[model samples]
Target: MSTAQLQYQSQSVAKPYFIAAIGLFVGQVLFGLIMGLQYVWGDFLFPEIPFNVARMVHTNLLIVWLLFGFMGAAYYLVPEEAERELHSPKLALALFWIFLTAGVLTIIGYLAVPYATLAKITGNDILPTMGREFLEQPTITKIGIVIVALGFLYNIGLTVLSGRKTVINVVLLTGLVGLAVMFLFSFYNPENLVLDKYFWWWVVHLWVEGVWELILGAILAFVLIKTTGVDREVIDKWLYVIIAAALITGIIGTGHHYYWIGTPSYWQWLGGIFSALEPIPFFMMTIFAFNMVFKRRKQHPNKATVLWAMGTGVMAFLGAGVWGFMHTLAPVNYYTHGTQITAAHGHMAFYGAYAMIVLTIISYAMPKLRGIGTAMNDRAQIVEMWSFWLMTVAMVFITLFLTAAGVLQVWLQRYQPNPMPFMAAQDQVAIFYWFRELSGVVFTLGLLLYILSFFIKGKQPAAQPTAA
Candidate 1:
């Protein structure tokens, strides 16, 4: 097939964004390793970088890179899905640099000065959205985010609205719009601690469990249709069904975070019931992915991308669904609320769902972006696959070790009659922290290999049949 005939010119806008995403992803992993070590060493960076600063950078980078991935995915897909070019490729490019510059500056501010100094320098006292967990971005930075999101939405919205409005494109647009809208709530941080916590979940939980799932679904559907040569009609209908299932369970599942807060007592049952069902959509996603691949009409040469897509389905279910359900119950959460179990679920869930999906899209899209044929060559792909297993396995061990630590900590500190003090409990769980840190090191190695695979030169593999 001719490259021009098969590719959209507007898709080129995504290349830079993906490149930035990968670069930030590496930084995120490195910071992650640093934080993991801080868990065991306590004084690894101490007053210089501090565990909290490293953690904030690690998490904030994760969110920023994922946003970059989402934007890239939209830029790449909207044109094709709409059967027309982007409304403003130049605008897209402009926003790309704007967002990237803003991100780098914010990160520099984060590292170069104390957070308080950074906040004062950024004028956080003007609106005071700082010091609130995930809303740590200065108010000015938050406004920048909103402006960027608006520009993004406008660009994507016009393209989708102007051309074909396929199920996938419409869903993606809606999700992006919803994401921006929910983020606005972060600016409304009242002084009441209960009220503060109450609305915090709106930005956090709603994005991850709600609109983000829609984004994930649409991207997965697009990839499946392209790679599997599945009927668009069939796949489109399934997209609606999957998204519907996601919203039905996930919206109510937001109640899960309300239990311990100063909210109504009935939230326990509501959260338990709804969050338990939240896994249904993820499970359906797994089945939908495999079934589509099994019934594929074409043998796509990019086996690595196929692996990524399928892995997103399976790992998202296991990490976000199964592990989430393990403690989402109000009773279980009451004990494991702030424990390492939450950390375990969080690490796995974010990696399995969001990180993996972004990587899946990039894996499928990058070769074409680079004009390197349908995918990376067999040798590079083999190395990429190796990184995938190494990272995935390392994450599994990290989660397990954290869970073990959490269980022991809960038993010794929370559940025991003569409960140990918090610091003593931490000391008791030090071994598990050591294990988690080691696993993080392995995860970093895997990440390094992943970066290296892109540079490997090798012959492209012939198309292989989809597995039975």
Candidate 2:
């Protein structure tokens, strides 16, 4: 083997991490399909699965995939950042198995025993399991997740503390730290409903909106600049811009959730005002990608991945961040909470912004890990890029349709007067749901093609990927 290949083979980054990431990817695509279909046909495939059950699948899959992908990236990055070999390849491998096992088992439990099963499984009735499945995490599963997080944190944290810390490394480390802290939220007992929501927001919302997003935006900008040969100074500048905007706005944005719950009146004011700026970072991301591409020092042969990354950054901000802002106001969101519009915002934002960024990282590293001298097969990149656009645009359409439906539903429920009649409102909004279902079908096709890309061989050398 060549020097680089030999070094790669002996290193922690050399194996296992990629396999874990790919597994998460497969699980994620399946979850997306399940969630998408459920939205369209409502009762078609998921009658057996239940809505909340499908929800846990969808949301948890995203968390797992992103977590695994981040682990893979950290494995790759930590050593590079430290300017030395990893502390322990064996430990890295151990973490892969531990985390992978924990993630997979958690999802399986979700499928087989959703919270509703708690009463039957454990002979307990006072605890409501079906609505909030976290209640069902069995002490074992909760402990397992904690163990996995600790193992990962120990491995990554050691590498960072012992190694050099660049601006990029600092940002990445911050994200991992945030991830570790956030997992702590999942540890609490769900029986405390109000407290559970508070903790849930801490784990789910804070990680995505605040810390990890900064990590995502930071890492994504790093890849774009590195690959495109843009000035690091410019790229880093953009990173500062996006993270600053996302955090300041996102942290306070938590207030939006306070509207319905038994909370102080200030949350309404806080959440609405800050969340309105949530899209600013997303908007900045779109500009960052396009601007970098336009001014690239040299054209990268892998046009498709570049396009997809940029597309994801832009769309995530617009679909998830911007549109989410529109109705998030306490005044507006009061009626639309738990509705399809929220679903629409979540789908586009996550897939477009967060999911795409991780995929972009995968695309960037694939050729590097394989040790191919130049670009991989351009054809696949182009095809994958097309799939990216198709899926995003299609999803946007679906969200738009759903948003229309949700607005109609909200207006009918809130304004038309309760006794004015359920039948009248139901009759008016029936067609919107039909439109959402139709849009969902198109979105599903796009996702299928995305999943297919993984199996299709690219033009690059066909060797196993290094996990780091």
Candidate 3:
């Protein structure tokens, strides 16, 4: 086989993963719309698909799909960065099927059975790892995840160790390892709520705010380097700075979640100060992306990828940095915690930082994976860009509407001289929920267009020659 064919065979492992991620993404957004409507209608899907069930599915789908994206990204980029084919393409493909099967079965179990029944059937009674938000996967499913992750890391790790080492693959591997390690805490549920919650942040806050940012930075840096023709040295420098800042702040920033969760008082100040600094890395990422793009040596034909790259920077800053800082301080968070404001931050931060980064990688890699040149045709690019703006604008509106609802919820439920009842407060915020649901509709449309762009045909560009 020629060098080009060998490279294609190596990278081809990523195509199914990307496809699965996008497919799951659509499911997540659909469930999100269902949950949004439930906020106002109160019984929109009721027993058939209760608000809690919809929420669990929505959140779980988000995590699962993003994991797929991350894995797909690693598979797509690691070999190239290492200057070799994968250590074991067969292992990567096998793990993909295993992970996907486990994920799909878990989701089916959630929707098909009652929570308690699912727990019983899945042997959660023996392990007791279910019931936590985002960690709601059954004990069996969690075990499957761990096994899949181990196999995955072994495959990627061997490839990276055997080939040339770059800062990108190294940092990415570090993050993936941390992700798997932190997830072990899900099985550490204690009878003490305080302890349970504390360790839970190890899995949740640490993943998103901590190591996952490492993954985000590495992926963004790789995309920027490819799209902008920037020197790896320059991008590597930014990656180091961003990763250091993200870890320094994000690890300690876990304190922010500790403030009211029966932790020590010192956490109030420690969490507040450190979490406040968390935005620095995201802000740095924004500058890093634009600077690299502005300094590009050549214009890559993948305009949609570049757009997603730039958008990831700006939006991650706005969502994760600015909006997150909006609530990181203990005093402000005291009022905003658990309110729609929290939802606003969660929605945008996840979208801006993780979801967009994943999509950015897919945008950059999918064309090449499909042998369709470095990008989609002009018409598809236009459609994809339209999807980008539509989804982004819709998300902004969703966040804003949720923020409005949150503020009102705070005032009526917490800030007022005489607080209203919880359900009463929810009733008062119904209008904002209506608006949020509408924004969700727009988001769904954007997602559909995004999916459509994949299939839309146009004049084909010459496939770029691949290398070994």
Candidate 4:
């Protein structure tokens, strides 16, 4: 084993966070399935679970689980990178329970009562932060979130500062701090819808496209360093270049959202050009991952993690980069705005860039958490690999079907000489909707199998290569 593989046990503080993350991930997929079914059946859950409510659960869970994953990643890696114990393990655990409790109560509020009722009970009337797309959480819940984020930052910040500072820890801390800062924008709700949306993108677009990429890059670099036995110098250098590109392109790319929100006419060109450049970093990431793998000094035992890391690069490029470019042009977006095409890009981008990276870190770390060596047995790994392909392929089909549905709807309802009404146009795309729903089912099955992989026990074998 390499010296780097002797990672300190202080990372154990991350275990509960990862467990909670996987549990919430299951909830996210289930709610997503509900939303997919609602698209086709419309009355699948009806009054008990309306499309809007289900959609809220689906999106919010994604956000929460990803946050959980990031927290876990930070807890797991920061201590090792800094060469010390966490500043306060008890504080990390306390924050975990607090965050999990708050998240559960908030989701229950979404599900158990009417949204209006939730707003009133949660004291949204004190401040109006509800009813917006992603900012639909009540003001009180938003406050809880802010408090949790601050506690998290304090815990991580002290740990990073107390020991040897590495490029990975510094980048992760910066990303996490930016996340908390930007989220403050969510508390700012203006009466003017235009201004509301402008700042809203500061939190929404900037988080995913900006600081979140920094978190993603840092985590990936840490994993690559541990897994590939690559020189930290090389990985550290690449991390700087990628994050620099991400911020340079992503901050200005917020203009794309401003274009339709009545910001200004000139934003169209600005949005088009800068948003077009947003994909460059993702493409660079793909090249970076494979290059590191081929130059590996030692083959890691955790093959699943390697697959996930490589997949992140490829899928992120296809979903976030290529698909995003498809409609980022001012002309194309003018037609496809708010269509299923946007949803298609979203599903792929989130899963590819964020979800896959979380799984990558979890896959690498969980075996150690379980007292196993560096990975699960070969049989479990094979099952995990199968689940990976199933989920990835299913997502691809879902995106294609939705993209087709969006195109058909645009033609029938917008581009036709005599356009059909919205509802009427929907009927024409029903087939695609059904296809998308079926693809979602496949994704769920894969998720279930992924869960089952943890329980399937086998002989402890050294890591073996699945490819030449």
TM-score of each: 0.97, 0.86, 0.97, 0.97
> Could you tell me the TM-score of candidate 1?
0.97
Over 358-420, each residue of candidate 3 has an lDDT whose tens digit, in order, gives 999999998888877777998999999999999999999999999999999999999999999
Q: What are the RMSD figures for all models against the true structure?
A: 1.7, 4.6, 2.6, 2.4
Candidate-wise lDDT, in order: 0.91, 0.69, 0.92, 0.90
Clashing pairs in 1: none
lDDT of 1 by residue, 1-468 (tens): 234523688888998999999999999999988988888788998889998889889999999999999999999999999999899999999999999999999889889999989988888777878888877888898999999999999999999999999999999999999999999999987989899899999999999999999999999999999899999999998889988989999998999999988999899999899999999889988999999999899888888888889989998998899989999998888888999989999999999999999999999888888878788998999999999999999999999999999999999989989999999999999999889989998999999899899999998776666543
State residue 118's C-alpha deviation in candidate 3, in Å: 0.5
lDDT of 2 by residue, 320-384 (tens): 77778878888778777876678778777777767777777766666556655334565566657
Pull out the clashing pairs in model 4.
none
- Candidate 1 has an lDDT of 0.91
Clashing pairs in 3: none
lDDT score, candidate 4: 0.90
